[model samples]
Target: MGLRKKVIWITGASSGIGEALAYEFNKKGAHLILSARRTGELERVKENCSNHEESVKILPLDLAEADQMEAKAVEALAMYGHVDMLINNGGVSQRSYAVDTEMSTVRKVMEVNFFGTVGLTKALLPEMIKQKSGHIVVISSVMGKFGTKFRSTYAASKHALHGYFDSLRQELYEHNVNVSLVCPGYVKTDVTINALTGSGEKFNKMGKGQKNAMPPEEFAKKLIPKLAAGKDEIYLGGAELMGVYLKRFVPGLFSKLLKRVRVT
Candidate 1:
């Protein structure tokens, strides 16, 4: 169960939860492959790691580019010959109301959040199955569990991930390739500021709730232990996590609460 010397590839690793997880995993002696669209930022994260020279490698990638995933996966596996884990953490966020959002924006979000993640997973899956060991972890949002205002397509994309990954997990059970979904509530990150608006422009403003959400480092600290324990589904955040349960058990009440809660 220990991650020591394990080859772990993490996407969206330039900042936020991905970066934090990179540092934590590096601390645990894991060989890290840090990936993101920005090679410079990935280098920055690498330099900040405990043993960057020997333990960390940077791979630049854009999750929205589905066609490139297969090659990327091949390159990732080449980093340390075989990967023990792949964390599907790269994605974009939406801040537009459903009525005002453009179709292109919806497609863009889905490309990065849903199809892109799925493509990469499929590309690497056969290798994992052949190795008879691997972990696929996704950083899905709490939105995957329920819906609210201003996140129609974002919620839809995450919901789709749940359905697809759930089915994939069942199929991979016999193959011994573990699939886990990490549902995170609001966390202190640039997700909101970088969120696409109705016109497909960046929101560029920090959200009220996001400003006070759990720190990425703290979230990573709590998540790594659960992952090491081989948990299938892990939820991390503050009180916002309650919304998931509330939506599941008391649909009527959760619907009412959503009307009043400040999501953005």
Candidate 2:
């Protein structure tokens, strides 16, 4: 279906890729329900969209507050009728060494990336199933495909998403609800700085490598159409996405290569 009439609900819309997708979809004529913890940033993003004159409702939220999510969905749905798609885009990254990482840090990341996605999707599945058509787009990462240096917990969180969403797709296929996962390498975002560490505080700044990553707006411009056409899984990045396939076929060499990576 065309994006023009779709009522899309996106989490983490305050900044980064989510904000970029907001504008992209708005330009394509989709109704938007933007959710994030920062209302001010959401307002700025809402205003930036080319079709600001259309319905653009902002819902402030912390995805990690998993218990209240269903109610949040209720409130969000009330804004626009039925949600045509729910983008599970809110998540935190882990930046400390796993050995030194506290249980709390790992749990927090899972809470947002894994459990939060689960809760929200679960709450909405029945409605979508009843409607017989819906799309759940998950924003996972290349880290989801393989573990890397300095990102053990982050890797685990993304890995968990692949497991969960893949199974959901299989289970729901007969019902006509589509679940697609997007695996992106790195886009220019404040993710590293906002990432959490062992003590449950921010990593405090962006990584050196992330400073030169692709811009979010450019990434979305390419990603939206593929999603609209029902592509099952998508991987976007320069050469980094190649590593996913390399590891699958020539795993021994891939393992050796990963040793030399100084991931920031």
Candidate 3:
């Protein structure tokens, strides 16, 4: 996973962490296939990159639409021959009261964040197995380790990612396919503002935790090497990495701490 000439495909590359990652990885000399719904923004990102402009390829599509991912992946493979790593970062977050949240909103978040990720992973896995080398990096959240108030669906989706990818790592070990789960806590991104509300509308703002979040570039700089080192799962956040170990070693106390936490 130490890039070099690795053919890496990153979904959700339009902005935020993904955009910063694209530039950083491009500088590292990885051939990139960038994916998102916004072709214009992809072009803009490509324009903004300081080097390796030709290394970036754009594949625009909605992650929620699982039907299209397999085909699009084929198109990517046709262009790049093979993908050494697939960073499944395309997802949405839902932050709303569980009781008041519409079923549609919950399902939409799962469809994009969990199930669609599954679809793309499954699609690319065969080739990975055949090549006997590939890495699947999932952009999960700190909520994956510990759930919180008003973010039920998003937490569940991220948690589901951990369940699936961790299992995949164990199952695919002999085949040389590695799985890395990235849990970022309150990264400075538009994620909170675009998070879905209970009524299936935009949340239209940021939470207090988000206001003091880590910069995406700094987060990526800290994270990429761990991934390159083949860490199976890693967490990123200012004060939130404590939650991951706390939940594992002291569940009851972690629960009590979470109860008093003012995440919003």
Candidate 4:
């Protein structure tokens, strides 16, 4: 029941949290379908995993290309005959102010973070419903629960994910398909450096907060067990996590505090 032999498909598996999750899942004896836009990086991740030659398979995917996800989902299903879990982890972040950011940049963020993730889930949903077994895990963020400066579109995308998956969990309740949202705080990843800017360019510089964040490997180690236990939602890392609750319980104070925070 705890990931042994489970066919788990992970997107964004080329690096960071997704890469760490791949190793953790591999160690837990789960067969993995590793995916990302970079085939070479996926292969590198696969090689670093346990029993890669047999249990790991690389599936290069670009989440922004929403049109291709259906076919990719089919390919994923064919690999292991059935996917026990689908980890929707591919996404991009923003580091530009709302007014300065181009509409194209906003749409691009939505395409990769929200629409694309939902599109793939929709593609695989029927099969999961038919089989009446599967888990849809999303790597959302603490930003999903609250707004922040220079991340208007990024926060919007994650907020959309929360709404979509929350509804999906309710609808799929009888279908035996579990939906889990993982809201990680500040995890050590290339998120800030790869974040999109006003002109749709990468920020290319890491934030100081990110440098002090929890290690992706350590975060994955704590996360996988809770996920396997079927947790509906899990939060990890720093004091920013407190904002998730404060936003709910003390909106006024949370709003004031959010404005003063150095979110970058």
Model 1 local distance difference test score = 0.93
Residues 1-264 of candidate 2 have per-residue lDDT tens digits of: 688868999999998999999988888889999999899999998888766766788989888988878898898778877999999998988888888899988899989989988998998898899889899999999999998888998899899999999999998898899998999987999999999888889998888767888899999998997898888898887788888998899999999999998888
Of the candidates numbered 1 and 3, which has the greater TM-score value?
A: 1
Show the lowest summed lDDT stretch of 10 residues, model 1. Answer: 255-264
- Those runs of model 2 whose alpha carbons end farther than 4 Å from true positions after fitting are 51-53
Candidate 4 segments exceeding 4 Å error: none
lDDT of each: 0.93, 0.89, 0.88, 0.93
List ranges where model 1 is wrong by over 4 Å. none
Residue 198's lDDT in candidate 4: 87
Q: Point out the higher-scoring one by TM-score: 2 or 4.
A: 4
Per-candidate alpha-carbon RMSD to the true structure: 0.9, 1.2, 1.3, 0.9
- Measured by C-alpha RMSD in angstroms, how accurate is candidate 3? 1.3
Which digits, one per residue and each the tens of the lDDT, describe model 4 over residues 75-103?
Answer: 99888899999999999999988999999
Per-residue CA lDDT of model 1 for 1-264, tens digit only, reads 788899999999999999999998998999999999999999999999987888999999999999999999999888899999999999999998899999999999999999999999999999999999999999999999998899999999999999999999999999999999999988999999999998899999998888988999999999998998888899998888998899889999989878987767
